[model samples]
Target: MAEQHAAGAEGIHPTNDPGTPGGSVDPQSGADSAAPTRRARRGGSRKSQKATGGWGAVREIAIVVVLALLIAFVAKTFLIRGYYIPSGSMEQTLELDDRIFVNVLGARTGHIDRGDIVVFDDTQGWLPEAPAARTNPVRQGLEFVGLLPDSSQQALVKRVIGVGGDHVTCCDASGKVSVNGKALDEPYLYPGAAPSDFPFDVTVPEGKFFVLGDHRNASADSRYHIETGTQFVSEQDVVGTAFVTAWPLDRFRFLHNPEDVFADVPAPARP
Candidate 1:
């Protein structure tokens, strides 16, 4: 008997053929499919990275621009400013070359007291012949930004002598101007000028102010209007007080409201 062949000798019963997968694809196609899937995943990752990098650059540029704008706005609003003197009105105290800085917040916050030098609008005709006197809408707008030169029309700076109702009589027996019956010893008065040469006896009206120049002889201030009995500047006309001589390092100085005088004076009675 020829070594009896095994009954089911076809070997293992033909496995479910993982390579054929229900007669769909061949073995090589399976390998080809995996290659494309990996390539597509890599391409998507590279595109995502590029998009992220582009947006990052844009965000950086936007941040820089925003910072620059913020800095400019802050400087314009609350920091150092420049102004030009338009006339001889505030001479000796503020000359033509003098560029000054004003403490606007202080003035608004009641830091401006008597004898504090101030800059304001001359719309009330304080300096009738000032170059900035006529139709100066452009100059007036620049005044708000502090960009215009000092000589701009419709602006002036003076000393606060009388606020509200105070008998602001001039040329007292001592040649001193009296406020509410007390005489002010003005040391800042210009040499050769005695308080005021032209006599004024009017009591400053309520809600109005009496301002004069440090250089009374040259200034056409309230005294000029008083001499003519024409126009007087009201307190509302005050823009803000000048507190510093900012430019020309040689002339740099801080202004103080003569402590010795205002200290003795009493507060004004409420109306």
Candidate 2:
């Protein structure tokens, strides 16, 4: 209290008021009385402004973060989504544990082309029923917002061999798979793996697709589901087209459809 009073006193300026009966001055110290209350109010106001500014900055940062997350979620839901390869079924093309970005819009008719890898839901019990995934809240939240790939999804990635109304068969005269009478010289197949270990010939029904894995021998794709007669995967069940190998920086690369492999093949005949 003593120090504050002395400090205020030292800051006082000498003044004389004409309205006073006699502009009397203090004999010891000549100065106007210091307004300590006003000074203290100004000091408190500065501190309050500083605190409000800090909170405002924080609020702005929070809004930006929320907007970014919303954009990611929208993209994941309708434009693109991320997934992690969990099996060797697509080996050599998509290695096990590789992360990939899938184009959700590409699942539409005519967008998904032959030789393009795709991710699809296992709708018809293609995959054995597994218990619900148990994940931590943090990791689950990240996946929900598209910051992390959802590796727990019950989905499969395979190459599109034939789409809607096309004839797809395995082991042509040259032991290669054929679509619409053109043999596929698949260089993406797993090393030492045949085009297909089993033979199958079928015309994909309208709005359905015949898919196979790059590692032919090890994959139980459309061919392995024949016993149920639901060998063809419906177009409606496709999640998206896997268009990149995204994880393990050393393996980062855009996934392109082997269009050249299907270019020479004629389109399916329309009835």
Candidate 3:
């Protein structure tokens, strides 16, 4: 009977002992199985963490690049700009091939004044060339991106001769132009060229302006437009008043309004 019972026990299979040596399970075998399972779980957790951190770093980098591009676009649109002179109309003040920086912000708020050398679109009346080269669609699009060609395509730089409502006339007895019946003693006029040799008497239209160049003889400015059959450049045509000479390191200077003479000129009486 005892031999039969032992034989029966040997035939029965051990149900849950995967780490057993010979089917008779030991506590050490179970402990060994636990170790491998714990190790695998730890390894998987570490790999997941490393992948998550790497992706997070990549996402941050992409966001920074996008922000930088947006800022560049905004600045190119309306704050400041670079301009290139393509003509010698403003010679001795601005030269050909000269790259200049313009402040578009200040001009937007009516801060432009007399004697300021301004850059404006010559689409209508100011361009000297025949078949005037106005701002074409392509150039207009490029202007927004700050990538316009390094040449003025129907743009000009000239000083504001008379503002909104000043009566401007040329060549007084002393050969000086007068604003509001007062002689303008201009110190910046080109050497040896009178304020204006040609004669003109016009009241500046409301919300309009009269502009001229410092270099009189060489410049074909308001005087020429009046002499020729072209409309005067109104304030609507003025782009922005120039405030600086940003070319030829030696000629750089701040262009302040020539206020000493016009300061005393009383505002024209309302008609």
For each candidate in turn, give its C-alpha RMSD to the true structure in angstroms: 12.4, 5.4, 9.8
**Candidate maximizing TM-score:** 2
Q: Could you give the candidate ranking by TM-score, starting with the highest?
A: 2, 3, 1
- Over 1-271, each residue of candidate 1 has an lDDT whose tens digit, in order, gives 1111221343223323555321223356444333444467689889999999999999999999777656644554555444556566666677766778776566555555677777777776654574434537766655444454445446778888877666677777888887776788877776667788777776767666688887888887787776666445665566677877777778888877776775566666556
- Candidate 2 global CA lDDT score: 0.84
Clashing pairs in 1: 84-149, 84-150, 84-151, 85-150, 86-151, 132-153
Instruction: Please list the residue runs of candidate 2 whose C-alpha ends up more than 4 Å from where it truly belongs after superposition.
Output: 1-30, 108-110, 135-141, 149-152
Worst 10 residues of 1 by lDDT: 1-10
**Model 3 segments more than 4 A misplaced:** 1-65, 128-142, 147-153, 227-231
lDDT preference between candidates 1 and 2, better one? 2
**What is the per-residue lDDT of model 2 for residues 1-271, given as tens digits with 9 covering 90 to 100?**
4535655677543346443221234557754233444567689999999999999999999999999999988898889988888899988999999999999987864487788798988888888887877789988888998787664767888999999889988878889999998898988999999998878899999888899999988898999988789788888889999888889899999999888999899989888
lDDT of 3 by residue, 1-271 (tens): 3333553677644435655422333466544333444567688889999999999999999998667656655665567666777777666667777777777776776776666777777766565575644787777656545666324546778888777778889778988898888888888776677777688887777776688887787788877776564535655555566667677787777767778857877778678
What TM-score would every model get versus the actual structure? Answer: 0.65, 0.83, 0.69
Clashing pairs in 3: 118-242
Worst 10 residues of 2 by lDDT: 17-26
